[model samples]
Target: MSTTPQRLMLTRTDGSPISALVVDDEAVLAEMVSMALRYEGWTVTTAGDGASAIAAARECRPDIVILDVMLPDLSGLEVLLRLRKLNPALPVLMLTAKDSVEDRIAGLTAGGDDYVTKPFSIEEVVLRLRALLRRAGITTDDGDSQLVVGDLVLDEDSHEVARDGESVTLTSTEFELLRFLMHNPKRVLSKAQILDRVWDYDFGGRSNIVELYISYLRRKIDDGREPMIHTVRGAGYVLKPAR
Candidate 1:
């Protein structure tokens, strides 16, 4: 039961044309979405299938992408996996007709930034796009920049991490999880909360992915050092400066 923070409203003064790519098997739907996005003054591109979506993404390097779950050639999840390997920071919004918790979880696990159900309002889609763009630091009011706690730091812009003057390398998922924890430091975050915030709607509480990744983070940030992330009995996990 993962959910994002909800829609965002942006003013016309945000400036610059945000580039986007839409991948869906439906031509009419794609064109319609493109037109709406264009109306917002964004540069939009379309790909009818997964393979072409990947190709367009590589060539275009869009700031955001709207990926439909069902594609004629490849599943949207498969396309997402490929896209993540190609560009981990690419913000992807997944569109699907299925609204089951399982379906949502699967989409999140595939590396989506947000999820929008089919037959949705165009305004809702625009809002989600704006929210993702804002989170990625492409908005006018705020920027992603770098996040830090004590000696540990997560550089959102450079995708790098360091603590106590030592470099730490983490996988993309690990980095995302750590960043979420750092962003919400000292807040008791349940597995559900972590899943929602870090993985978006597509990750249903399927497996021990969060626990496994927490262990990974501990190894890097806490093992053989002053502990920063701690587990509260029957509660959840918390990250804070070592006491």
Candidate 2:
């Protein structure tokens, strides 16, 4: 069975919906990235060239910009300079088809906050944007910053997890996986879904990684308490409040 990817509904620190500007000469890629950002509950604006990007940045004052290194008019570096002049603190994640280290350095040296090579997964783009947002001090609203299922609690902002009043230590990957499960408590999540959401890429038939992480979570979350994470016969894993 397939399930629609869940919307994160993250917001700006000021409690407003986060906004983003996507600048790519490739119309399809721009729209695809914009759609993913919008799915994350962000207001997104797309520009096909450097000129439109600058104009949009001035008008929208987006919280972040997903910039394409290659633009039809001015180079992405030039656009980055213009954008910095408008809002020096605005976070920018550069997208480049070039995977060369020098190319990456050029983008970073030109004041880009982060960079992702092309042919990337949408999940990777989303994950990188979230990290950039957090670093820029834009994060979930206070009311929506944590997830709770029964005795388990996960703090999105603090990256802390606790169960039954006891704090549980989790690695970054583990935290993300648990957070995904917590978001859809009681619903079965297939390994493919878990891989996409947590790893941000296809694992090429390697599902044991999910199993490994699930076992790690169980040891910490279910050890000496009723289990909350359970696997169905041949379906997937589900999290439920311990009965």
Largest TM-score belongs to which candidate?
2
- Work out candidate 1's RMSD over C-alphas: 12.2
lDDT of 2 by residue, 156-232 (tens): 76788999889999999999899889878889999999998888777799999999999999999999999999998
User: Which candidate wins on lDDT?
Assistant: 2
lDDT (10s digit) by residue, model 1, range 33-108: 9998987778888999999999999998888899999999999999999989888988999999998889888998
Q: Against the true structure, candidate 2 has what lDDT?
A: 0.87
The segments of candidate 2 whose C-alpha lies over 4 angstroms from its true place after superposition are 1-16, 118-140, 143-145, 156-158, 200-206
RMSD of each: 12.2, 4.3
Task: Return the TM-score for candidate 2, rounded to 2 decimals.
Answer: 0.77
Off by over 4 Å in 1: 1-15, 141-243
